[model samples]
Target: MLETDRLILRRFHKDDWQDLYEYLSDEAVVRYEPYGAFTEEECKQAAISRANQEFFWAICLKERGGEVDPIAQAAGKLIGNIYFQQQNPPDFMCWSLGYVLNPRYQGQGYATESCQAIMEHGFTKMHVRRIAAMCNPENTPSWRLLERLGLRREGHFIKHKFFKRDAKGNPLWTDTYLYAMLAEEWPVK
Candidate 1:
Protein backbone atom coordinates (compact mmCIF):
# COMPACT_ATOMS: atom_id res chain seq x y z
CA MET A 1 0.00 0.00 0.00
CA LEU A 2 1.15 3.54 -0.67
CA GLU A 3 0.28 6.28 1.80
CA THR A 4 0.27 10.01 1.42
CA ASP A 5 -0.49 12.79 3.87
CA ARG A 6 -4.21 12.61 3.11
CA LEU A 7 -4.70 9.45 1.09
CA ILE A 8 -3.73 5.81 0.71
CA LEU A 9 -2.99 4.42 -2.72
CA ARG A 10 -3.60 0.71 -2.94
CA ARG A 11 -4.72 -2.01 -5.34
CA PHE A 12 -8.20 -2.09 -6.90
CA HIS A 13 -10.52 -4.76 -5.50
CA LYS A 14 -13.72 -6.59 -6.31
CA ASP A 15 -15.55 -4.33 -3.87
CA ASP A 16 -14.65 -1.38 -6.04
CA TRP A 17 -16.62 -2.59 -9.05
CA GLN A 18 -19.75 -0.60 -8.34
CA ASP A 19 -17.93 2.63 -7.67
CA LEU A 20 -15.59 2.01 -10.56
CA TYR A 21 -18.55 1.59 -12.83
CA GLU A 22 -20.11 4.83 -11.70
CA TYR A 23 -17.00 6.82 -12.40
CA LEU A 24 -15.79 4.85 -15.40
CA SER A 25 -19.13 5.36 -17.09
CA ASP A 26 -18.86 9.11 -16.90
CA GLU A 27 -18.07 10.74 -20.22
CA ALA A 28 -16.20 13.62 -18.59
CA VAL A 29 -13.95 11.35 -16.57
CA VAL A 30 -12.87 9.23 -19.53
CA ARG A 31 -12.83 12.05 -22.07
CA TYR A 32 -9.07 12.38 -22.24
CA GLU A 33 -8.44 8.76 -21.37
CA PRO A 34 -8.01 6.12 -24.03
CA TYR A 35 -11.21 4.29 -23.15
CA GLY A 36 -14.56 6.01 -23.29
CA ALA A 37 -17.36 5.24 -20.86
CA PHE A 38 -17.58 1.61 -19.77
CA THR A 39 -20.55 -0.68 -19.60
CA GLU A 40 -21.42 -2.35 -16.27
CA GLU A 41 -19.98 -5.67 -17.35
CA GLU A 42 -16.92 -3.89 -18.64
CA CYS A 43 -16.42 -2.30 -15.26
CA LYS A 44 -16.73 -5.66 -13.52
CA GLN A 45 -14.26 -7.31 -15.84
CA ALA A 46 -11.87 -4.41 -15.42
CA ALA A 47 -12.07 -4.55 -11.68
CA ILE A 48 -11.37 -8.27 -11.76
CA SER A 49 -8.44 -7.81 -14.10
CA ARG A 50 -7.09 -4.91 -12.04
CA ALA A 51 -7.32 -6.81 -8.78
CA ASN A 52 -4.55 -9.06 -10.04
CA GLN A 53 -2.28 -6.28 -11.23
CA GLU A 54 0.67 -5.27 -9.09
CA PHE A 55 0.88 -1.58 -9.93
CA PHE A 56 -2.71 -0.41 -9.96
CA TRP A 57 -4.26 1.55 -7.09
CA ALA A 58 -7.72 2.25 -5.74
CA ILE A 59 -7.10 5.75 -4.39
CA CYS A 60 -8.76 6.63 -1.12
CA LEU A 61 -8.44 8.76 1.98
CA LYS A 62 -6.98 7.04 5.02
CA GLU A 63 -9.64 4.88 6.66
CA ARG A 64 -7.94 5.52 10.00
CA GLY A 65 -6.04 8.58 11.00
CA GLY A 66 -5.58 11.31 13.55
CA GLU A 67 -8.22 13.98 14.19
CA VAL A 68 -7.47 15.36 10.79
CA ASP A 69 -8.94 12.32 9.11
CA PRO A 70 -12.11 13.18 7.24
CA ILE A 71 -15.20 11.64 8.82
CA ALA A 72 -15.67 9.55 5.67
CA GLN A 73 -13.20 7.25 3.96
CA ALA A 74 -12.28 7.56 0.28
CA ALA A 75 -13.71 4.44 -1.42
CA GLY A 76 -17.29 4.62 -2.68
CA LYS A 77 -17.00 8.24 -3.71
CA LEU A 78 -14.11 7.55 -6.08
CA ILE A 79 -12.69 11.01 -6.66
CA GLY A 80 -10.57 9.24 -9.26
CA ASN A 81 -8.66 6.07 -10.14
CA ILE A 82 -5.02 5.63 -11.17
CA TYR A 83 -3.10 2.79 -12.80
CA PHE A 84 0.38 2.06 -14.04
CA GLN A 85 0.40 0.12 -17.29
CA GLN A 86 3.60 -1.88 -17.49
CA GLN A 87 5.84 -1.56 -20.50
CA ASN A 88 5.59 -4.38 -23.07
CA PRO A 89 8.95 -5.93 -22.11
CA PRO A 90 8.93 -6.77 -18.43
CA ASP A 91 12.67 -6.23 -18.30
CA PHE A 92 12.24 -2.54 -19.00
CA MET A 93 11.84 -0.53 -15.80
CA CYS A 94 9.16 1.78 -17.06
CA TRP A 95 5.40 2.30 -16.90
CA SER A 96 2.61 4.47 -18.23
CA LEU A 97 0.51 6.26 -15.61
CA GLY A 98 -3.19 6.74 -16.22
CA TYR A 99 -6.03 8.25 -14.14
CA VAL A 100 -9.63 9.52 -14.24
CA LEU A 101 -11.58 11.33 -11.52
CA ASN A 102 -15.28 11.91 -11.11
CA PRO A 103 -16.33 15.20 -12.62
CA ARG A 104 -17.92 16.28 -9.36
CA TYR A 105 -14.55 15.79 -7.65
CA GLN A 106 -12.56 17.69 -10.21
CA GLY A 107 -10.47 20.72 -9.10
CA GLN A 108 -10.46 19.50 -5.52
CA GLY A 109 -6.80 18.49 -5.80
CA TYR A 110 -7.55 14.78 -5.48
CA ALA A 111 -5.93 14.05 -8.81
CA THR A 112 -2.66 15.58 -7.75
CA GLU A 113 -2.74 13.82 -4.41
CA SER A 114 -3.24 10.42 -5.99
CA CYS A 115 -0.60 11.07 -8.64
CA GLN A 116 2.04 12.17 -6.14
CA ALA A 117 1.43 9.03 -4.12
CA ILE A 118 1.72 6.88 -7.24
CA MET A 119 4.86 8.61 -8.38
CA GLU A 120 6.50 7.87 -5.06
CA HIS A 121 5.40 4.26 -5.33
CA GLY A 122 6.66 3.94 -8.89
CA PHE A 123 10.12 5.37 -8.34
CA THR A 124 10.91 4.38 -4.75
CA LYS A 125 9.07 1.09 -4.37
CA MET A 126 8.43 -0.22 -7.87
CA HIS A 127 12.01 0.63 -8.95
CA VAL A 128 10.81 2.29 -12.14
CA ARG A 129 13.39 4.44 -13.85
CA ARG A 130 10.99 6.04 -16.27
CA ILE A 131 7.36 6.90 -15.62
CA ALA A 132 5.25 8.36 -18.39
CA ALA A 133 1.72 9.50 -19.29
CA MET A 134 0.03 10.25 -22.56
CA CYS A 135 -2.40 13.12 -22.85
CA ASN A 136 -4.67 14.48 -25.55
CA PRO A 137 -3.60 17.96 -26.56
CA GLU A 138 -7.20 19.11 -26.58
CA ASN A 139 -7.64 17.90 -23.04
CA THR A 140 -6.16 20.88 -21.27
CA PRO A 141 -6.65 19.57 -17.75
CA SER A 142 -4.62 16.41 -18.30
CA TRP A 143 -2.05 18.29 -20.31
CA ARG A 144 -1.50 20.72 -17.46
CA LEU A 145 -1.60 17.99 -14.84
CA LEU A 146 1.37 16.21 -16.43
CA GLU A 147 3.37 19.39 -16.28
CA ARG A 148 2.41 19.88 -12.64
CA LEU A 149 3.78 16.40 -11.87
CA GLY A 150 7.16 17.50 -13.16
CA LEU A 151 6.93 15.26 -16.21
CA ARG A 152 8.42 16.89 -19.26
CA ARG A 153 6.62 16.91 -22.56
CA GLU A 154 8.44 14.33 -24.65
CA GLY A 155 6.52 14.83 -27.88
CA HIS A 156 3.18 15.71 -29.39
CA PHE A 157 1.94 13.38 -32.10
CA ILE A 158 -0.76 14.33 -34.53
CA LYS A 159 -3.47 11.94 -35.64
CA HIS A 160 -3.22 9.28 -32.94
CA LYS A 161 -5.90 6.59 -32.89
CA PHE A 162 -8.03 6.13 -29.80
CA PHE A 163 -10.99 3.89 -29.05
CA LYS A 164 -14.03 4.08 -31.30
CA ARG A 165 -17.13 5.98 -30.24
CA ASP A 166 -18.87 2.64 -29.96
CA ALA A 167 -17.95 -1.00 -30.36
CA LYS A 168 -18.74 -1.10 -34.07
CA GLY A 169 -17.91 2.49 -35.00
CA ASN A 170 -14.93 3.64 -36.97
CA PRO A 171 -11.99 4.99 -34.93
CA LEU A 172 -11.17 8.65 -34.72
CA TRP A 173 -7.79 10.34 -34.70
CA THR A 174 -6.82 12.94 -32.13
CA ASP A 175 -3.64 14.78 -31.31
CA THR A 176 -1.86 13.04 -28.45
CA TYR A 177 1.08 13.90 -26.24
CA LEU A 178 3.66 11.86 -24.38
CA TYR A 179 5.10 13.14 -21.14
CA ALA A 180 7.73 11.48 -18.97
CA MET A 181 9.80 11.71 -15.83
CA LEU A 182 13.05 9.84 -15.15
CA ALA A 183 14.47 8.82 -11.77
CA GLU A 184 17.37 11.22 -12.18
CA GLU A 185 15.07 14.02 -13.19
CA TRP A 186 12.64 13.78 -10.28
CA PRO A 187 12.19 16.88 -8.23
CA VAL A 188 14.14 16.93 -4.95
CA LYS A 189 12.06 15.64 -2.09
Candidate 2:
Protein backbone atom coordinates (compact mmCIF):
# COMPACT_ATOMS: atom_id res chain seq x y z
CA MET A 1 0.00 0.00 0.00
CA LEU A 2 1.16 3.54 -0.84
CA GLU A 3 0.09 6.59 1.09
CA THR A 4 0.26 10.25 0.20
CA ASP A 5 -0.64 13.05 2.58
CA ARG A 6 -4.33 12.92 1.61
CA LEU A 7 -4.65 9.66 -0.27
CA ILE A 8 -3.88 5.98 -0.03
CA LEU A 9 -3.12 3.72 -2.98
CA ARG A 10 -4.00 0.15 -2.07
CA ARG A 11 -5.35 -3.06 -3.40
CA PHE A 12 -9.02 -3.13 -4.32
CA HIS A 13 -11.58 -4.85 -2.13
CA LYS A 14 -14.73 -6.66 -3.21
CA ASP A 15 -16.71 -4.02 -1.39
CA ASP A 16 -15.17 -1.29 -3.55
CA TRP A 17 -17.58 -2.12 -6.38
CA GLN A 18 -19.90 0.72 -5.53
CA ASP A 19 -17.04 3.19 -5.39
CA LEU A 20 -15.64 1.93 -8.68
CA TYR A 21 -19.08 2.20 -10.22
CA GLU A 22 -19.34 5.82 -9.20
CA TYR A 23 -16.86 6.75 -11.97
CA LEU A 24 -16.91 3.69 -14.21
CA SER A 25 -20.61 4.16 -14.80
CA ASP A 26 -20.16 7.76 -15.83
CA GLU A 27 -19.86 8.23 -19.55
CA ALA A 28 -17.77 11.37 -19.21
CA VAL A 29 -15.20 9.59 -17.08
CA VAL A 30 -14.83 6.82 -19.62
CA ARG A 31 -15.02 9.01 -22.71
CA TYR A 32 -11.37 8.66 -23.73
CA GLU A 33 -11.19 5.04 -22.63
CA PRO A 34 -11.72 2.19 -25.01
CA TYR A 35 -14.47 0.78 -22.83
CA GLY A 36 -17.86 2.40 -22.45
CA ALA A 37 -19.66 3.17 -19.25
CA PHE A 38 -19.96 0.13 -17.08
CA THR A 39 -23.03 -1.50 -15.58
CA GLU A 40 -23.16 -2.27 -11.87
CA GLU A 41 -22.58 -5.94 -12.63
CA GLU A 42 -19.55 -5.06 -14.70
CA CYS A 43 -18.23 -2.89 -11.91
CA LYS A 44 -18.68 -5.67 -9.40
CA GLN A 45 -16.91 -8.14 -11.62
CA ALA A 46 -14.17 -5.63 -12.34
CA ALA A 47 -13.64 -5.02 -8.66
CA ILE A 48 -13.43 -8.74 -8.04
CA SER A 49 -11.04 -9.27 -10.91
CA ARG A 50 -8.86 -6.31 -10.03
CA ALA A 51 -8.57 -7.38 -6.41
CA ASN A 52 -6.45 -10.34 -7.47
CA GLN A 53 -4.12 -8.39 -9.70
CA GLU A 54 -0.61 -7.63 -8.44
CA PHE A 55 -0.40 -4.17 -9.95
CA PHE A 56 -3.89 -2.67 -9.81
CA TRP A 57 -4.62 -0.25 -6.95
CA ALA A 58 -7.63 1.62 -5.67
CA ILE A 59 -7.03 5.32 -4.98
CA CYS A 60 -8.79 6.40 -1.81
CA LEU A 61 -9.04 9.58 0.17
CA LYS A 62 -7.37 9.60 3.57
CA GLU A 63 -9.70 10.46 6.40
CA ARG A 64 -7.62 12.50 8.77
CA GLY A 65 -7.46 12.35 12.55
CA GLY A 66 -9.80 9.54 13.44
CA GLU A 67 -10.05 6.80 16.00
CA VAL A 68 -9.65 4.29 13.21
CA ASP A 69 -6.16 3.75 11.78
CA PRO A 70 -5.12 5.92 8.86
CA ILE A 71 -5.10 3.03 6.42
CA ALA A 72 -8.56 1.94 7.45
CA GLN A 73 -9.87 5.49 7.21
CA ALA A 74 -8.22 5.96 3.85
CA ALA A 75 -9.70 2.72 2.57
CA GLY A 76 -13.21 3.99 3.14
CA LYS A 77 -13.47 6.45 0.26
CA LEU A 78 -12.36 5.31 -3.19
CA ILE A 79 -11.58 8.11 -5.62
CA GLY A 80 -9.73 6.47 -8.50
CA ASN A 81 -7.73 3.50 -9.82
CA ILE A 82 -4.29 2.81 -11.32
CA TYR A 83 -2.52 -0.12 -12.87
CA PHE A 84 0.66 -1.17 -14.68
CA GLN A 85 1.12 -4.10 -16.97
CA GLN A 86 4.54 -5.61 -17.54
CA GLN A 87 5.54 -5.57 -21.16
CA ASN A 88 6.24 -8.79 -23.05
CA PRO A 89 9.34 -10.67 -21.90
CA PRO A 90 9.24 -9.98 -18.18
CA ASP A 91 13.01 -9.69 -18.19
CA PHE A 92 12.76 -6.57 -20.31
CA MET A 93 11.92 -4.61 -17.17
CA CYS A 94 9.37 -2.46 -18.92
CA TRP A 95 5.74 -1.72 -18.01
CA SER A 96 2.82 0.28 -19.31
CA LEU A 97 0.96 2.52 -16.88
CA GLY A 98 -2.73 3.32 -16.84
CA TYR A 99 -4.91 5.34 -14.54
CA VAL A 100 -8.38 6.86 -14.05
CA LEU A 101 -9.71 9.51 -11.72
CA ASN A 102 -13.24 10.49 -10.86
CA PRO A 103 -13.98 13.66 -12.84
CA ARG A 104 -15.06 15.31 -9.62
CA TYR A 105 -11.51 14.92 -8.35
CA GLN A 106 -9.67 16.16 -11.42
CA GLY A 107 -7.41 19.27 -11.44
CA GLN A 108 -6.33 18.57 -7.87
CA GLY A 109 -2.91 16.96 -8.57
CA TYR A 110 -4.05 13.63 -7.18
CA ALA A 111 -3.42 11.91 -10.50
CA THR A 112 0.10 13.26 -10.59
CA GLU A 113 0.78 12.24 -7.01
CA SER A 114 -0.58 8.74 -7.49
CA CYS A 115 1.23 8.23 -10.79
CA GLN A 116 4.52 9.52 -9.40
CA ALA A 117 4.29 7.07 -6.59
CA ILE A 118 3.59 4.23 -8.99
CA MET A 119 6.47 5.22 -11.23
CA GLU A 120 8.80 5.32 -8.29
CA HIS A 121 7.57 1.96 -7.08
CA GLY A 122 8.08 0.50 -10.51
CA PHE A 123 11.57 1.85 -10.90
CA THR A 124 12.81 1.17 -7.38
CA LYS A 125 10.82 -1.68 -5.91
CA MET A 126 9.93 -3.53 -9.09
CA HIS A 127 13.36 -2.93 -10.60
CA VAL A 128 11.78 -1.76 -13.83
CA ARG A 129 14.04 -0.14 -16.40
CA ARG A 130 11.41 1.79 -18.32
CA ILE A 131 7.78 2.85 -17.93
CA ALA A 132 5.44 3.86 -20.70
CA ALA A 133 1.96 5.30 -21.01
CA MET A 134 -0.40 6.26 -23.82
CA CYS A 135 -3.41 8.48 -24.14
CA ASN A 136 -5.74 9.67 -26.84
CA PRO A 137 -4.55 12.85 -28.56
CA GLU A 138 -7.80 14.52 -27.62
CA ASN A 139 -7.15 13.77 -23.95
CA THR A 140 -5.16 16.91 -23.37
CA PRO A 141 -5.11 16.63 -19.63
CA SER A 142 -3.89 13.07 -19.74
CA TRP A 143 -0.99 13.69 -22.11
CA ARG A 144 -0.11 16.82 -20.20
CA LEU A 145 -0.09 14.81 -17.01
CA LEU A 146 2.27 12.31 -18.62
CA GLU A 147 4.55 15.12 -19.72
CA ARG A 148 4.44 16.72 -16.30
CA LEU A 149 5.50 13.42 -14.81
CA GLY A 150 8.64 13.56 -16.99
CA LEU A 151 7.66 10.97 -19.57
CA ARG A 152 8.74 12.22 -23.00
CA ARG A 153 6.32 11.96 -25.88
CA GLU A 154 7.82 9.41 -28.24
CA GLY A 155 5.24 9.10 -31.00
CA HIS A 156 1.86 10.16 -32.24
CA PHE A 157 -0.10 7.44 -34.00
CA ILE A 158 -2.82 8.81 -36.26
CA LYS A 159 -6.11 6.95 -36.29
CA HIS A 160 -4.38 4.20 -34.41
CA LYS A 161 -7.09 3.33 -31.98
CA PHE A 162 -10.78 2.61 -32.40
CA PHE A 163 -11.77 3.90 -29.00
CA LYS A 164 -15.49 3.43 -29.13
CA ARG A 165 -18.63 3.80 -31.16
CA ASP A 166 -20.00 7.22 -31.92
CA ALA A 167 -23.57 8.36 -31.18
CA LYS A 168 -24.50 6.97 -34.59
CA GLY A 169 -22.87 3.61 -33.73
CA ASN A 170 -19.97 4.10 -36.12
CA PRO A 171 -16.44 3.25 -35.07
CA LEU A 172 -14.69 6.25 -33.58
CA TRP A 173 -11.03 6.18 -34.47
CA THR A 174 -8.68 8.51 -32.64
CA ASP A 175 -5.00 9.39 -32.55
CA THR A 176 -2.76 8.45 -29.63
CA TYR A 177 0.34 9.85 -28.02
CA LEU A 178 2.89 7.43 -26.61
CA TYR A 179 5.16 8.54 -23.81
CA ALA A 180 7.93 6.85 -21.88
CA MET A 181 10.67 7.41 -19.32
CA LEU A 182 13.79 5.43 -18.63
CA ALA A 183 14.71 4.69 -15.05
CA GLU A 184 17.89 6.72 -15.51
CA GLU A 185 15.75 9.75 -16.27
CA TRP A 186 13.58 9.38 -13.18
CA PRO A 187 14.78 11.33 -10.19
CA VAL A 188 15.28 8.99 -7.30
CA LYS A 189 13.67 10.15 -4.09
Candidate 3:
Protein backbone atom coordinates (compact mmCIF):
# COMPACT_ATOMS: atom_id res chain seq x y z
CA MET A 1 0.00 0.00 0.00
CA LEU A 2 1.14 3.55 -0.76
CA GLU A 3 0.07 6.57 1.27
CA THR A 4 -0.07 10.24 0.41
CA ASP A 5 -1.15 13.01 2.72
CA ARG A 6 -4.85 12.49 1.97
CA LEU A 7 -4.99 9.28 -0.03
CA ILE A 8 -4.07 5.62 0.13
CA LEU A 9 -3.10 3.62 -2.95
CA ARG A 10 -3.79 -0.03 -2.26
CA ARG A 11 -4.74 -3.18 -4.08
CA PHE A 12 -8.38 -3.57 -5.09
CA HIS A 13 -10.61 -5.82 -3.02
CA LYS A 14 -13.82 -7.69 -3.82
CA ASP A 15 -15.69 -5.25 -1.60
CA ASP A 16 -14.52 -2.40 -3.84
CA TRP A 17 -16.62 -3.65 -6.71
CA GLN A 18 -19.59 -1.48 -5.84
CA ASP A 19 -17.51 1.62 -5.40
CA LEU A 20 -15.77 0.98 -8.72
CA TYR A 21 -19.11 0.40 -10.39
CA GLU A 22 -20.31 3.79 -9.23
CA TYR A 23 -17.89 5.42 -11.69
CA LEU A 24 -17.22 2.60 -14.12
CA SER A 25 -20.95 2.57 -14.94
CA ASP A 26 -21.03 6.26 -15.67
CA GLU A 27 -20.87 7.03 -19.39
CA ALA A 28 -19.45 10.50 -18.81
CA VAL A 29 -16.57 9.10 -16.83
CA VAL A 30 -15.72 6.30 -19.23
CA ARG A 31 -16.46 8.04 -22.53
CA TYR A 32 -12.83 8.59 -23.33
CA GLU A 33 -11.78 5.26 -21.89
CA PRO A 34 -11.20 2.42 -24.30
CA TYR A 35 -13.61 0.04 -22.52
CA GLY A 36 -16.28 2.68 -22.08
CA ALA A 37 -18.91 2.09 -19.37
CA PHE A 38 -19.23 -1.30 -17.76
CA THR A 39 -22.09 -3.41 -16.42
CA GLU A 40 -22.24 -4.38 -12.76
CA GLU A 41 -21.05 -7.86 -13.59
CA GLU A 42 -18.21 -6.47 -15.64
CA CYS A 43 -17.31 -4.14 -12.78
CA LYS A 44 -17.22 -7.10 -10.41
CA GLN A 45 -15.03 -9.00 -12.81
CA ALA A 46 -12.81 -5.99 -13.24
CA ALA A 47 -12.42 -5.66 -9.49
CA ILE A 48 -11.55 -9.31 -9.20
CA SER A 49 -9.18 -9.19 -12.13
CA ARG A 50 -7.44 -6.08 -10.89
CA ALA A 51 -7.15 -7.48 -7.40
CA ASN A 52 -4.96 -10.19 -8.85
CA GLN A 53 -2.58 -7.74 -10.46
CA GLU A 54 0.51 -6.33 -8.75
CA PHE A 55 0.50 -2.89 -10.36
CA PHE A 56 -3.13 -1.89 -9.99
CA TRP A 57 -4.17 0.22 -7.02
CA ALA A 58 -7.47 1.43 -5.63
CA ILE A 59 -7.19 5.10 -4.71
CA CYS A 60 -8.84 5.59 -1.34
CA LEU A 61 -9.30 8.71 0.71
CA LYS A 62 -7.37 8.55 3.97
CA GLU A 63 -9.40 8.74 7.12
CA ARG A 64 -9.37 12.02 8.99
CA GLY A 65 -7.75 12.86 12.39
CA GLY A 66 -4.26 11.85 11.26
CA GLU A 67 -4.35 8.66 13.32
CA VAL A 68 -3.86 5.22 11.83
CA ASP A 69 -6.65 2.78 12.60
CA PRO A 70 -7.72 -0.50 11.10
CA ILE A 71 -11.37 0.48 11.15
CA ALA A 72 -10.54 3.69 9.35
CA GLN A 73 -8.60 1.79 6.75
CA ALA A 74 -11.46 -0.65 6.27
CA ALA A 75 -13.92 2.21 5.99
CA GLY A 76 -11.85 4.34 3.68
CA LYS A 77 -13.81 5.40 0.63
CA LEU A 78 -12.49 4.43 -2.80
CA ILE A 79 -12.35 7.48 -5.04
CA GLY A 80 -10.25 6.32 -7.99
CA ASN A 81 -7.61 3.92 -9.30
CA ILE A 82 -4.14 3.93 -10.89
CA TYR A 83 -2.29 1.24 -12.74
CA PHE A 84 0.89 0.60 -14.70
CA GLN A 85 1.27 -2.33 -17.05
CA GLN A 86 4.57 -3.49 -18.41
CA GLN A 87 4.54 -2.52 -22.08
CA ASN A 88 7.61 -4.16 -23.45
CA PRO A 89 9.97 -7.06 -22.97
CA PRO A 90 11.51 -7.40 -19.51
CA ASP A 91 14.82 -6.12 -20.88
CA PHE A 92 13.14 -2.93 -22.13
CA MET A 93 11.90 -1.80 -18.73
CA CYS A 94 8.92 0.14 -20.07
CA TRP A 95 5.42 0.54 -18.66
CA SER A 96 2.12 2.18 -19.57
CA LEU A 97 0.07 4.14 -17.05
CA GLY A 98 -3.71 4.47 -16.77
CA TYR A 99 -6.14 5.97 -14.27
CA VAL A 100 -9.77 6.78 -13.53
CA LEU A 101 -11.63 8.70 -10.86
CA ASN A 102 -15.16 9.34 -9.67
CA PRO A 103 -16.70 12.33 -11.44
CA ARG A 104 -17.87 13.72 -8.11
CA TYR A 105 -14.21 13.76 -7.10
CA GLN A 106 -13.02 15.61 -10.17
CA GLY A 107 -11.08 18.89 -9.90
CA GLN A 108 -9.69 17.77 -6.55
CA GLY A 109 -6.11 16.91 -7.72
CA TYR A 110 -6.55 13.29 -6.56
CA ALA A 111 -5.64 11.99 -9.99
CA THR A 112 -2.36 13.85 -10.02
CA GLU A 113 -1.50 12.73 -6.50
CA SER A 114 -2.33 9.10 -7.16
CA CYS A 115 -0.43 9.14 -10.47
CA GLN A 116 2.63 10.73 -8.90
CA ALA A 117 2.74 8.09 -6.23
CA ILE A 118 2.39 5.28 -8.76
CA MET A 119 4.94 6.80 -11.11
CA GLU A 120 7.42 7.15 -8.31
CA HIS A 121 6.84 3.55 -7.33
CA GLY A 122 7.24 2.37 -10.88
CA PHE A 123 10.47 4.29 -11.37
CA THR A 124 12.12 3.54 -8.05
CA LYS A 125 10.82 0.26 -6.70
CA MET A 126 9.83 -1.43 -9.97
CA HIS A 127 13.01 -0.34 -11.79
CA VAL A 128 11.03 0.97 -14.74
CA ARG A 129 13.13 3.01 -17.14
CA ARG A 130 10.28 4.54 -19.11
CA ILE A 131 6.58 5.20 -18.56
CA ALA A 132 3.94 6.25 -21.05
CA ALA A 133 0.29 7.28 -21.00
CA MET A 134 -2.25 8.22 -23.62
CA CYS A 135 -5.64 9.91 -23.69
CA ASN A 136 -8.10 11.25 -26.22
CA PRO A 137 -7.03 14.58 -27.63
CA GLU A 138 -10.27 16.14 -26.51
CA ASN A 139 -9.82 15.05 -22.93
CA THR A 140 -8.33 18.36 -21.85
CA PRO A 141 -8.33 17.65 -18.16
CA SER A 142 -6.62 14.32 -18.62
CA TRP A 143 -3.89 15.51 -20.98
CA ARG A 144 -3.40 18.57 -18.84
CA LEU A 145 -2.89 16.40 -15.80
CA LEU A 146 -0.28 14.43 -17.70
CA GLU A 147 1.49 17.66 -18.59
CA ARG A 148 1.34 18.87 -15.00
CA LEU A 149 2.95 15.61 -13.94
CA GLY A 150 5.92 16.52 -16.18
CA LEU A 151 5.30 13.90 -18.85
CA ARG A 152 6.32 15.13 -22.28
CA ARG A 153 3.80 15.03 -25.08
CA GLU A 154 5.44 12.71 -27.56
CA GLY A 155 2.90 11.95 -30.26
CA HIS A 156 -0.59 12.70 -31.47
CA PHE A 157 -2.24 9.92 -33.41
CA ILE A 158 -4.98 11.11 -35.67
CA LYS A 159 -8.18 9.06 -35.88
CA HIS A 160 -6.33 6.11 -34.48
CA LYS A 161 -8.57 5.12 -31.60
CA PHE A 162 -11.92 3.45 -32.14
CA PHE A 163 -13.25 4.03 -28.65
CA LYS A 164 -16.93 3.13 -28.88
CA ARG A 165 -20.11 3.39 -30.88
CA ASP A 166 -22.08 6.58 -31.11
CA ALA A 167 -25.86 7.02 -30.84
CA LYS A 168 -26.10 6.03 -34.48
CA GLY A 169 -24.14 2.86 -33.79
CA ASN A 170 -21.25 4.13 -35.89
CA PRO A 171 -17.73 3.60 -34.69
CA LEU A 172 -16.44 6.57 -32.75
CA TRP A 173 -12.91 7.32 -33.80
CA THR A 174 -10.87 9.85 -31.92
CA ASP A 175 -7.39 11.27 -31.95
CA THR A 176 -5.05 10.40 -29.11
CA TYR A 177 -2.09 12.13 -27.48
CA LEU A 178 0.73 10.12 -26.00
CA TYR A 179 2.79 11.35 -23.08
CA ALA A 180 5.94 9.80 -21.76
CA MET A 181 8.72 10.23 -19.19
CA LEU A 182 12.07 8.58 -18.72
CA ALA A 183 13.40 7.63 -15.30
CA GLU A 184 16.42 9.82 -15.86
CA GLU A 185 14.11 12.81 -16.51
CA TRP A 186 12.02 12.30 -13.38
CA PRO A 187 13.15 14.46 -10.51
CA VAL A 188 14.02 12.53 -7.40
CA LYS A 189 12.33 14.21 -4.46
**TM per model?**
0.84, 0.91, 0.91
In model 1, what are the clashing residue pairs, if there are any?
none
Alpha-carbon runs more than 4 Å astray in model 3: 64-70, 167-169
lDDT of 2 by residue, 1-189 (tens): 987877789989889999899899999889888788999999999999999997898888786333445456655578899988899999998999999998878899989999998888888898999999999988899999998899999999999979677789998888989999999998733
lDDT of 1: 0.77
- C-alpha local distance difference test of each model: 0.77, 0.87, 0.87
Residue 177, model 1, lDDT: 93
lDDT for 141 (candidate 3): 91
Q: What lDDT is reached at residue 189 by model 2?
A: 32
Q: Which pairs of residues clash in candidate 3, taking residues 3 or more apart in a chain or in different chains?
A: none
TM-score of 3: 0.91
